[model samples]
Target chain A: MSGASLAIPDRLRLLRGANNEGVLAVVLLALIVAMSIANPAFFTLPTAFSILRSSIVPLIFALGVLMVIISGGIDVSFAAIAVFAAYTTVRALQSGTPDLGLIGAFALALLIGASLGVINGFLIAKFRLPTLIVTLGTQGIFKGALLTYVGSRYIADLPASMAQVSTTNLFEVSTPTGSAYLHILVVPAVLLAIGLAWVLRSTMFGRSIYAIGGDVEAARRAGIRVMRTQVAVYVIAGTMAAAGGMIYVIMGRSASPQILVGSELDIIAAVVLGGASIFGGRGSVLGTTLGVILVQVIYNSLILAGVPSAWQRTAVGVLLIIGVGIQAVASRRSSRASVIDETYQKQEVPA
Target chain B: MKLADPETKPLSRLNDSVDAGWTRLLGLGRIEGGVRRMLILVVVAFAVFAALKPSIFLSGTNLRNIALNSPEIGVIAIAMMLAMLTGGIDLSLVAMANLSAITMSTMFTAVAAGDPALAEQLFPVILLAGIAVGVLGGVINGLLISGLGITPILATLGSMQIYNGIAVAWTGGKTLYGSPSALTAIGSSTVAGIPILFYVFVLVAVAIGVVVTRTPLGLRIQLQGANPTAARYSGIASRKILLSTYVLTGLLSGIAGVLFIARNPTASADYGASYVLLVIVIAVLGGTNPNGGFATVLGVVLATLTLQIVSSGFTAMRLSAYQYAIAQGLILVAAMAFEQVRWRRRRRSRKPAVQPG
Candidate 1:
């Protein structure tokens, strides 16, 4: 009875809740605390920096995917796009007379990502073809192109400046145990995450993405150019995935078709685990960051605990099931709330 | 909205009759929306194949090759069509097929250990083992999706990983060789100017066709898939229907696995991974709408032939392996575009017919 009379301010705050990001923050804190207690070495700066380095590339792509999902679509070609981008960049460097050099290569790769994303958007939004079908076809095309372009030959030697990004670390940070560690190339990833979160929260375009996803037809009727917004979303996603791919090449020191063969599933799962709906509209970049961390943590913990690497796939499989299950439950609750709302509204109307 | 205006009613009726007649003649009325497209694709494909490879296209040997290659996929396609028809997908079919292949191959190698001739004689035994493994896999998928409230796509996806993992683990990532001769004979031997496996595929397809067209069970499944909420409200058990379809698909895929083992005489971790996309493509191309309540088995069979010819043509032409991916993608795009064109045409013609009244 008292809840029904709640203040508008309190209700709005409740409706636009802190969401899955808050859950992620709690999970991150709990993970750090538990891991630290289990192994004091876990809290050391070196270990932390190493984890950060490992997380950078995936984290970047995950942000891009988070944007796509929030805009109510999916891009399964992220890994493929990244592979192509890396291939292009490496092929550029190998010719000695580097066309775009490092910065130019990355910019071109991002442009390709965005362009391919636009193609995906055109097929899905304009043609009214199912997203799954178009993406599946595009994925095949991307993979095929990668295979044909590289033809099993990997570029081993790269320009020193480009290769040095992975190994270069900042000054050492002192730890409680009198130990010190350096930050690796992942230094940029952390900065990128913070910047992305800021833009997503404060920008007008970011708000439009949420609005479009939440109610596409309504948004369109309200004079929002749905097609353009969706196309822009895919372009951004493509660019980010391209950036992630480059980072991956830097870390791994080579680009292989098999490197991230089944990685798209992991990216999607991470986004879903972070509580993003496959149906679109509601999600957070912070939540996705945690989702990636959760996945990595699970993988890392399993390795540290001496579990076989094969079981890592099983862990992902199980996590996917659990993630979908939670989403299903959440969907049911939201629908039930709508039903209750309708009933209340009908009662408020004149007989 | 009144479809009975005097000025248009007679012409509309005539148009409806012609549409119905045309669809029935092509076997489109026997299933759902996609089946008609598949039928059209088959015509387009056969004409193209015959034109491109005239000498070999009409030859008995090539026709027999098409037959032999089909059963392994054909049976599985039947199950897959049912699953897709119900508004769900079974990504695990290929994985299940691999598992069954491994199981059968393992059983063959075990029973005939150091006795190749004896293993050759026990072909039926291997086939039974493959079918059994497939049924078991299907049961697991059905139970998980139906009994556990898991969505078909996610459930099957999870099962895909699990099945593949089990297959890999069971074989310890090693290929199983020295399969039974009887199974191989079923794959290779010709009977009455046709391949044995082809007959088996025909029988399976016809059996499934009959079940889908004539049985109450099939009717309930179609109803359930067409609208789960409506079906559930009408007292149909949607969960059971879904579970049974998954089971059916798994069982058929298992049969396909055995045929694959029989033909290849080997099983590996990578045995069925490639088939996953191909299977979906063929099923969709065959005229089985994943969200529709009906499918055309014959259309799928014809489309399979067309696709196989295209694949063989590509290989024969010495194209890069990557080209096959491009071809498949293009074909899928074309099929979808064709469906959209037909849908638009139907919508356009119907609007004018209604508006004039």
Candidate 2:
């Protein structure tokens, strides 16, 4: 082959690696312009802030799920935990406990989330049960707990601080149509995302998760505390879910059984669409954030275009299929090429 | 391990020859044979239900109702068992059932609108549509999983959304109901004081059992599931086998869809959503290995009956539907947990290793 042609695969590999974030950044920009075209009202700071605000729960979920998925175990019950946390938070606020105030309630919920996660980790690591079955089992348990605690009763009339932080706006930003307000909640949410990204990219513990996902036995043999890492991953996942749950309760001003119904799938889809491997070993928090934004943009654009609510699931479902299909195809090609390269190298060796 | 004893083999062989021997008459040695534990659990469940609610559980009418109401779920569970036996899962089974049922219902509606008198004549069309929808879904699953080499669970998950979304979008979120009388009769009408669907499940179970035990295709499929590398090295086209397994699963799911719609007579978007877990539970309980390639069709059928009886018995005893749902979920968790413990115990008993190998 010619030198240029021989470099094609190398170029393709480089493009695959480096072009993911760039492509997503471009997609986000395009979506903003397209959404604005559909409704000039969509270009306002209020709409942007609202989208960012709406994104926080899923973003938190995505961050936690990223670590678990990278560590080679999935927590499908995170969504259920979110519902339970939100319900508990709302009830605590409603009951007006003096000892367990808002901060105490939040901390208590986080502890519950961590405990549940640890329980999940213990079951999987100790019993060696398949992650899918274990998670499915615990999902039922948590759902049962939520039902027992909430009893079909929703807690309303949140404390003023919680309500204000959830709904109040920062200074307005000018738009083509009109100036609009930005929410204060996005500030903390962004800070949380940034902090998570730092932990994932810079911490040794985070690196261990990636290593474990790559090869569990190898990591174990290399002196990594595999069980401890797994437990930590699940605990963080749970904590993030609880955080998201409380934020969701504050924003929605209510808690219901169906609050987070079937949301785990969406969170997973976001993670995968963001280029996180389902098989684990690799994922990026930055990419996950963009993935969340992409999903919101798609959702918001559909509404702005007045495509009708019934068609929304269908559209998103189609997008999921297409996105997964592309990933499948790309991975297949890379693996095939790698196999070929291995064979060629083997043949060249002194056998 | 005791069941696989070398000493018992000689006695077991002798008992097989002495057809009317005292040991055989006592049902003593048979407990050592295929899926005896499952059979015992099922028998105990039946006895308890019969004793607790004799008026409801053991009655012919109630039995028939239980059989009729659950056959579709049972049928799909059998399909799930087959896929699981091949060391893979078809998460799209529920979605496939939904799509197939919707297709059949939609087709029936189309035919009835053309000629109201031709309503009964469209039964075959509905059946064909159901099977066709299932096959198409299976093909997509097989192509992605086998051809493209995607992991079965993830691949089937993607297929689930695509299949279900199409069904919903095709119908515009509307339920297609009031199907032809003949179509509904498949579920509603009884033959010889038994629901037709029960017989259908029995035949399916027998057919699958025979195929798995007696046919090369079935043998190869299981082999591929049990040990893919070895099967491929032995000159078996493992991919083709995997593909066929998914297609068969899809076909059975389609049949289930037709039966499900007939029983309900209302094909909503949620037609098969709640059945996914129930199907898995029945399949796993029946003797299918959730991880891969080991199952008994007979075990699945029996487990389906036992579970259906328990749920129906609960309903008969004035328990609310939510209670039944909760009980079902708990039983499912218990069953899976029990299986996991059994598996770990067995593994622990095997040759111990110091490392991952």
| CAPRI tier of model 2 | acceptable
TM of each candidate vs. truth: 0.85, 0.87
lDDT of 2: 0.77
lDDT per residue for candidate 2 within A1-351, as digits (tens), equals 444775776766554454265556677788899888878878777677768877878888888888888887776878877777767766666665554555776787787788878877887776666666667667766776667545667566676656666667767777665667676666767887898878877888978898998899999999999888887888788888888887788778766766785767768877877777777887788778888888888888888888766565556556666666766787789889999999999999977
- lDDT (tens digit, per residue) of candidate 1 on A59-109: 888888888888877667788778877777677666675556567767777
Model 1 misplaced regions, further than 4 Å: A1-47, A96-99, A149-152, A170-184, A195-202, A257-259, A329-351, B1-40, B43-65, B108-129, B352-357
Q: Which 10 successive residues of model 1 chain A have the least lDDT summed?
A: A13-22
Candidate 1 residue lDDT tens string, B1-357: 756678788899999999989988878446455555566666776677778776777577777777777777767767778888788888888888888888888877887777777777777777888888888989988887787667777777767766776776677778888677767766788889888888888988898888787997788888887888899999998888888888888888887887788788898766856667677778777877767675778777776766777766665456676877778777876777678777888898889878865
**How good is model 2 by TM-score?**
0.87
Candidate 2 chain B TM? Answer: 0.85
